[model samples]
Target: MKPAAFDYHAPATANEAVALLADLGDEAKIIAGGQSLVPMLALRLAVFDHLVDLRRLDELGGIEARGDSVWIGAGTTHAAVGRSAEIRRDIPLLHRATPLIGHFQIRNRGTLGGAIAHADAAGEYPVAALTLDARMHTLSPRGTRDIAAADYFTGMWSTAMEPDELLTGVTFPVWRGRTGFAIEEFARRAGDFAMAGATVAVRLDADSRIEQVALGLFGLAPTPLRATTTESEVLGRPAADIDPAEVGRSATAALNAVPADIHGSAEFRRRIGAVMVARAWARAVEEASND
Candidate 1:
């Protein structure tokens, strides 16, 4: 099947995009990377009367650092972000997670903003955004606003963004000293959507104890979920005292009702998610120790 017939509009500026969206309302869909949307459109899973292309917007295509935070333009490609020296230096977690997103070809065209806007539960960008506590910036004909990652995702394939809103960019606060980061994911094959994945960022004090931790988990829920239960359990604890296997299990123990599908059972996914969280936690500890 092919996508429903739609009028296409290429907007050269952010404001123009916002105006198009406002005028078209819910009938308009923004196309950036077109990685996810194109497939959906091909399958007739999604339909729109208008396609608002943001590729020509030069304003939404760069990486910049402002003080303790880094702002990544919505139009920036995964490949561009992966190769950025500044992003690698300022935000190691994102740099490390980028390679896991599909393959080189997909990365070359996939935009970070597109991924976040899609809000796929198993998406790499959503996991990074959640773990990093990134802030999403949006523009509408009415005004502009910033939505915290915590509040941005409401459910699978759903977000806080309104129909007329345009996601301009995202800002992530840089983690400095004594921080270690790791990403662990399980997929049927390379470049396939992960069955389950976890990203861990840990900070240690001078005593080598865990000072802070953020765990973002995917593929086990409707939305990318932060393992707050696990964080509370492990925070300020000595790394040596925490067992990776046990921590992994306990981290997702509360989610006994995880979704079951053709790829896996609820139990199987929970088990895989647990192990990922454990591995990520262990690797993060090692990273922090060596830092």
Candidate 2:
């Protein structure tokens, strides 16, 4: 089915786009790459009276280093992100998660900001962002605001962003010390949305003690989640003393809202989620140990 009749808008600048949204009110929606929105629109799952296109806004499309973090413009495509050497070197988790987003054709047209804003629990980028504690930047008539990744995702396909706000970019902190990152997910087929997934980041001290770690779980909850309980359990423990399987169990044990559908029941998803956490934890520790 085709999308219902709606007015198309191409704004030359972000300020203009937000202005249009502010004027259009709740009836308007922002369109970046349209990889996700197009499907929703075609299916009549989402209807917008006006679409403020950001395609012409060159300001929202670039990658740059900012102090100890990398800032990726919201309009940057997934393929562009995967091709970026800086992203691969500085933020390996994000780079690694890029190829798992549907197919090459989808990635070619999918934008980083769109993925995060769409806020799918199974999306690789959302889980990666949560794992890295990335910061989201937004613009509105009121001015610019920064939202932490932990607080950014509020519910299913919902965010803290106001209707008039435009997501401008994301800032991912660069880990400087001996660090390792890995993401693991279980999907029925290649390029399918994961049933459950985990993204792990670990920084180890010289003596093989865990200095810092993050376990971000996706496809197991309504929103991308951080396994804080499990992280706290192994925070200062020696790498050899911690068991990945135990950590996985602890991570999923605290989850209360794992989704259940035809693909899998909540209990089944938790089981898969635990395994993903365990696998990701093992790989991440191995890399950190080698470093």
- Please name the candidate that would achieve the greatest lDDT relative to the true structure: 2
- The C-alpha stretches of model 1 lying farther than 4 A from their native spots are none
User: What are the models' TM-scores?
Assistant: 0.98, 0.99
Per residue, candidate 1 scores C-alpha lDDT tens digits across 1-291 of: 889999999988889999998888889899999999999999999999999999999788899999999999999999999999998888888998899899999999999999999999998889899999999999999899999999999998999999999899999999888999999999999988889999999999898888889988988898999989889888988888889898788778887457788999989999999999989988998989998
Worst 10 residues of 2 by lDDT: 254-263
Q: How high is the CA lDDT of each candidate model?
A: 0.91, 0.95
How big is the positional error of residue 109 in model 1, measured in Å on the Cα after superposition?
A: 0.8
Off by over 4 Å in 2: none
Task: Report residue 183 deviation for candidate 1 (angstroms).
Answer: 0.5
Best by TM-score: 2
lDDT for 106 in candidate 2 is 93
Cα-based lDDT at residue 52, candidate 1: 93
